[model samples]
Target: MDWSSKTVMVTGATAGIGAATALRFAEAGATLIITGRRKQRLETMADVLTSAGANEVYIHRFDIQKKEQIAAVVKNITADTLSVDVLVNNAGLSRNFSPMWEDNTDGWDDMIDTNIKGLLHMTRALLPGMIDKNSGHIINIGSIAGHEVYQNGAVYCATKHAVKAITASLRLDLFKTNIRVTSIDPGLVETEFSEVRFYGDKERAETVYKGFQPLTAADIAESVFWSASMPEHVTIAEMLVLPTDQASATMVYKK
Candidate 1:
């Protein structure tokens, strides 16, 4: 697949699956627009993408939770005469692990704002261009939690469920157009997700992956690349990726 003329925009490109996907697209010779809230990390990723064979690498720092910032960035990109060929909505986080009654309301806000609202903001800002051209692909980074619920993860699961709904609805709404929509839902991939969920408790985060060989950021990235690289007429609408030891969101086996 030739991505020489493609312009790929990835949110949350500072680390984890987002960073991996950016590099994957870079290797395909795409012009890259990588966004993240961390300024330094975003710049570093930009340098790495440039060195990795990206035709052009642009970095933007902004919180996806901020609607105005999303709009401003999209405006800037349009002014530069670049429309995204692929939009990877991967800016998301899990904040806490507790049952609904005991969970922090702040955690609920964070997950809903980032995982649900943030995804909406980006898609709203960029979908119009795709419609005008009648060409593009939107790959949403979802989780198996979207499909199944687990204890102490009600809010997080709810947000992902919203992602599933949004992805499906967007595809239906765009059915008349040539645009494609897909949701890449992974069961588990070792990343900063656990650390953030545990509020920087590194010890606890490490434990989540201690007994098993969890999926890596690169593994999910490969899936994203393949989905976007498929023929325009074909859309791998929804995918559930998990490690061999994992069966479902709540059914991971540990040795």
Candidate 2:
């Protein structure tokens, strides 16, 4: 694919996999639209992405958990007359590790609102343009948890499972169109993920990858880029990426 002429939009681009993916595309010389809640971080990223060779860089500051915020961002994109060639739904989180019976309702709500509802809102917002143009790609960042359940992660897993289902069903929904949909399901990745999940307990988060090499944000970014770069005739419907030391959500070879 000639990325130089394409415009890519990535949600949650302020950090983690989203930032890496944006940087990857920028290095390919693509125009970029990166959205996140941190205005300062977004500003810094825009400069960094531009320096990384993005043809042009744009940033939108908004909280994905709110539909109003998402709609406002979409309105701005439309007003700017920017047509996104690829949309990466990358903004998501896990609030805590409490099991279902003892989990905070607030945490549950956070996970659902951001992981599931946010994704739906963003996709619905951008999908019409893709359909109207009859050309586009939607890459959803899923997780290994989507395929398996684990203790104390029931709510987070449920959200990702929903992502998996949505991605599959969306492919069937758009089968007749020229548009493409893909899900990139990754295993453990060492980023803010653990810290966020553990509520900023850096010591606790560090132990999650103590004895083995977990995937990095850039590693997942490379997978996302590869999926997006495939021929138009080819659609990578789903991908499950894991560190060699990790076999499943709960099975980590830490030795």
Candidate 3:
């Protein structure tokens, strides 16, 4: 439970689940390295983390979609004498909700680039240090979409499905070592996720969570903290979290 000696790197720490997760670790006394594309927000989050009890907070501004940027940041962290004890790959997005044939190609590009490629780049950049030390936890923020494909969300679903595959494969690959890999998939969380998916349409986004008690960013954050705080010998391979009214990706019971 004492994370004072640990260092945790969280991608997409500007808002939502990423921000919540960073704060959770901070409350546990971890040294935090938080990254996001928004410079100002990342800085603000760093300050918040410091105020929340983190031993140290480092803010890095870069798009995870860029491999060079990821590598450069990781290198700088290493140079600073910080060995990451946990890596949270939570930088991801869902662009649109259209059938595969009618969907815009740009949406596809954004989803694939951010959801799949971004996760790979961060893992690739940080896994080396963990392997050399033979200790680390990689917590991926996947989705229920990874387990089931919903109507008009084919590409987004595919990207999450790939997350599931990658998480499994990465765990197996690290089985010989003490490195741990886990995917935390959530059904419905009331956050900016819906707003972003709807291209900033507030009303439309509100409809998605209407008449239902959806999970919050803090809920998922708690799960991440729990998974990372487990005994070194225990590895939780995968966890699927959903709201009480939700059963799966497509089955949400609204009041």
C-alpha root-mean-square deviation, each candidate: 0.7, 0.7, 0.8
In candidate 1, position 138 carries an lDDT of 94
Error of 2 at 14 (Å): 0.7
Candidate 1 stretches with Cα past 4 Å from truth are: none
Model 3 Cα lDDT, one tens digit per residue, 103-166: 8889898899999999999999899999899899999999999999999999999999999999
Task: Give candidate 3 misplaced runs (Cα > 4 Å).
Answer: none
Question: Which residue pairs collide in model 1, if any?
Answer: none
Instruction: Compute each candidate's TM-score over C-alphas.
Output: 0.99, 0.99, 0.98
Q: Model 1: how large is the Cα RMSD against the reference?
A: 0.7
Model 2, clash count? 0
Ranking by TM-score: 1, 2, 3
Instruction: Give a tens-digit lDDT track for model 1, residues 1-255.
Output: 689999999999999999999999999999999999899999899899999999999888999999999999999999999989999999999987987888889999999999999999999999999999999999999999999999999899999999999999999999889999999999889999999999999999999998889999999999999999998889999999999999988777998
TM-score of 1: 0.99
Error of 3 at 254 (Å): 1.1
Error of 3 at 55 (Å): 0.6
TM-score attained by model 3: 0.98
Instruction: Estimate the overall C-alpha local distance difference test score of candidate 1.
Output: 0.94
Worst 10 residues of 2 by lDDT: 95-104
Give the 10-residue window scoring lowest on summed lDDT in candidate 1. 95-104
